[model samples]
Target: MTYWNQEIETMDPVRLRGLQSERLVKLVHYVYEKSPFYKKLFDEKGIKPEDIKSIGDIQKLPFTYKKDLRDTYPTGMFCVKNTDLVRIHASSGTTGKPIVVGYTQNDITNWAESLARGFTSVGLGKDDILQISYGYGLFTGGLGAHYGSERIGATTIPISSGNTERQLSLMEDLNVTAVLCTPSYFSYLIEVAEKEGRSLKNNKSLRVGIFGAEPWSESLRHRIEERSGIKAYDVFGTSELSGPLFTECPEQNGMHVWADMFIVEILNPETLEPVKDGETGELVVTTLLKEALPLIRYRVGDLASIENTVCACGRTHPRLMRLTGRSDDMTIVRGINVFPGQVESVLMKIPEVSPHFLMMIERNGELDDMTVQVELNDLASDKVEDYNRLISRISHDLRTVLTLSVDVELVNPGTIPRSEGKAKRVIDKRKF
Candidate 1:
C-alpha cells in the first residue's frame, strides 16, 4: 500500500513502545526544565523528572486539566518564548479564558507530517486537488489541514469556510478531488446543492471527505457518503494536540493514533487508572515530540477506547474507537465548541435575564440547531417591544461568546422548573 513515512507508521510494536519510552524519558526532563508550570506541578506533587523513566510510569505523573490551561492563560504554559513561536492558536474559551497554544518551526513541521500521513493513507497525493472548508484564524483546523495538503504536494484551495455558493462553484470549476470540513457543514452543502438542482452524487471529481471537529455516527457517515458520493473519513485532534492529527485508513475503521508522537491512555474518569483495552474511558494524552507546548497526561475529556490489535490496514499504531461522548459538559454546534457556563456568563451580564436557563440542541435536517430557553428576572419589563429588544440583545451576546447563532426564548420568571439538587442546564436531542 502507498504510505507516508512508512518507517515510523509501520514500525514493530515492541520497537514503537521502546521509542515511546525513550521519548517519555526525555520529555519529562525537557518539560520540567523548560516550563515553570510543569516544574511547579511536579514539585507540588513531590515527583521528579527521574520518576518518569518509562511509559509505564506515566500514571505516577499528575493529570493536567482543562481548567489548568485557563489558569495559565495566554503563554504561561508554553515552554518557548514568544519570539521562538512560529504560530499561535487558541480555544473558543467556552468555559473561561481561551486555552492558548504555540508552535515552534519544528513543531509545525511535525504537525504537518502527522496530517500528511493521514491524507496519504486514504490515497490522496500530489495529483489531488483538495478543498479545505474549515474556518481559519485563531482556530487550528484551516491552517493545519492546509499545511498538510501542501506537504503531500497536493494542490490546495484554502476556501476557509462560509460563502456556500462560491465553495460549490470552485468544487465544480477546479475539479476538487477531496474536501476537508465538519460533517454538519458538508451536510448543509448537500442541501444547498439539491436546492440549486445540482447533484453531488453525480459529481465526477469529488472522491474523498476528511470530516471531524465534532462527534458523528456511522448513520451520519452513510448519509454523507450517499449524498456526496465520497468516502467519508473521520479525522480527530484538538488544537492542544497539534490539530487534526489522526485519520481513518482505506479500511474505514477506527482512526489510527500516531504512536511515535503521542502516548494515549484510556483511563477511568473517576479512578484515573487505565481501563482494559477495548473498554471506553476518558482519553488522556502525553505529547512525546511537541516542542513549544509539550503536555504530559493531559486529560482530553473525550470518552473513547483504544484497540491494541493491529489495524487491518497494516499500521501498528493503536486505533481510537468511535468517541462515545465528552467527560465534561462541553457541546459542539456547527463545529464550534460551546459550554453552558459561557451562556450563563452572558446571561449574568444582562439585568433582564435570570440564571435559570435551559439549552436545547436538536438536529434540523442535517444541521444542528441550538435553542436557549431562559427565564426573565422579576423586575423585567412585560412589553412586547421590550421583550423583542431583550431577545435580540441576548442572542447577539450569546453569538459573540459561542461563535454560533442560537435561538433565544425569554420565558416568565417561574416558567422553568426549579431543581433542589444539581441543576440541569442542557437537553441534547441529537442522536449522535
Candidate 2:
C-alpha cells in the first residue's frame, strides 16, 4: 500500500524518457489519423506524424489553448465517438462557452489510478473514512475524489458540499479521518466549529486534508495545520488534465507528476521556450495515455516551477512547486501587475485578518481603482480607532510588497462570501 505502481513510479530517468518518446511517436500518428482537428492543424503547419521522432521534437507541434477547446465546443476535439465515452465533465463557463471533456472506460481507470496513488501517498486506506466536501455533478472535484476514495477501499461519505451543521455532525459522528475540499471551505469550517464551542484540534479522527481547486500559499497551509491539527497536502490538476492528477508525498515537498502518463514542460509565457529547472513559468503538458481527448502541448495557464531531482520519498517523477498564480488571472492595476496570490500572502501574515478576502477593481474617471475587502478575525477589536489602525497597517504592508497603493477595507468576520467550490477572489468592473 505504500506505493501504487511502484515500477513505473520509480522508473529510471532514461527509460522514462524512452517510454515518453515512444508514446509520443505513436500518439502523433494516432491523432493525425483519428482527429480531424489535429489533422487540419498538422496539414496547415506542413508537418506529418513522421516528423515527431522523439520527445525533443515535440516543440515542432502547435500549442493548444483553452480557446481551442471552446472553439471545438461539444465533441469536435474528442477522438472517440459518444458511444465510447463513459462520462463527461465541463468547466463552469463563467467567462464564455464551457469546455467539455470526455472520458472512456480506460480514461476513467487511469484517472482513478492517478488519484489512488495520491490518496495512498497521503496515508489513506480502507480503514479511513473520507468526507468529500467538493461539489458534484458537472464539476470534476467531487466525483473524482469519490472514485479515488473508493479505489483505495476507504469508507467514503460522498457528501457534496454546503450544510455546515450536517458537515460538522457527520465529522464527529462518522469519525471522518480524511476530507477533500477547497482550503477556503475548510477555513470556514474551522470558524463555524469555534462558534459552536468545538475545536478541530481536539478531534481525534481527522488526520489528513487534501486541498486544491484554487491557488493557496504556504502561510495558509500552516494556518490550516495549526487550526485543524492535520497534515495538509495540496492536490493539483485541471478538468482538461483529468481533474486531480498530482499529490504531494508524505514529505510534503511538492506534488509529484506521473511521468509515465504525462510530459510536463515549464515554458516562458511570451517566448514559449523552456525555462531553466526550478524557475517559475507557464505549465504546458502533453498527455500520453488519454484515449478520448488527447491534447498535445496544452497550455494549462498555471504559473509554477518543476524540480526533476529525486525526492526524499524515492519517487523519480518530477515535482511541481506550489503554484504562484495563473498567467490569465494576473491583473494590471494602475499600471502595476497584481496577483491574487500576492494579496493572499500579505493577508495571511496579518493575524488580525482572516484568510477570506475579495479584491474589487473599478474604473473611476479614466483611472483604475483597486480596493481590498478583508474580514477581521474574531479576536480583533471592533473599536473605531482599532479598525482605522488595522486598515492602515494592512494598506502599508500591501503597498510595501506589491509596490503599489491599494485601499484596504476592514469588515466584521463572515463579511466576505464563503465558497464551497473555488473561491472567487477577483471582481473587475472596468468595461474593457
lDDT of each: 0.86, 0.91
Candidate 1, which segments miss by more than 4 Å at Cα?
Answer: 94-96, 330-432
Best-performing candidate as measured by TM-score: 2
**Segments of candidate 2 deviating more than 4 angstroms:** none
Query: What is the overall TM-score of model 2 with all chains considered together?
Result: 0.97
Model 1 Cα lDDT, one tens digit per residue, 318-343:
99977754656778888888877677
Candidate 2: Cα lDDT at 186: 91
lDDT (Cα, tens digit) per residue for candidate 2, span 1-432: 388778888889899999999999999999999999999999999999999999999999998888889888987989998889999999766456779999999999989999898889878999999999998889888999999999999999999988988999999999999989998899988889978988888899999999998899888998889988999999998999899889999988899999889999999988989999999999999999999999999999889999999888878899999998878789999899989989998999888889899999999998999999989998799788988888999999999989999999888898898988888899999988
TM-score of 1: 0.78
| Per-prediction tally of clashes | 0, 0
Clashing residue pairs found in predicted model 2: none
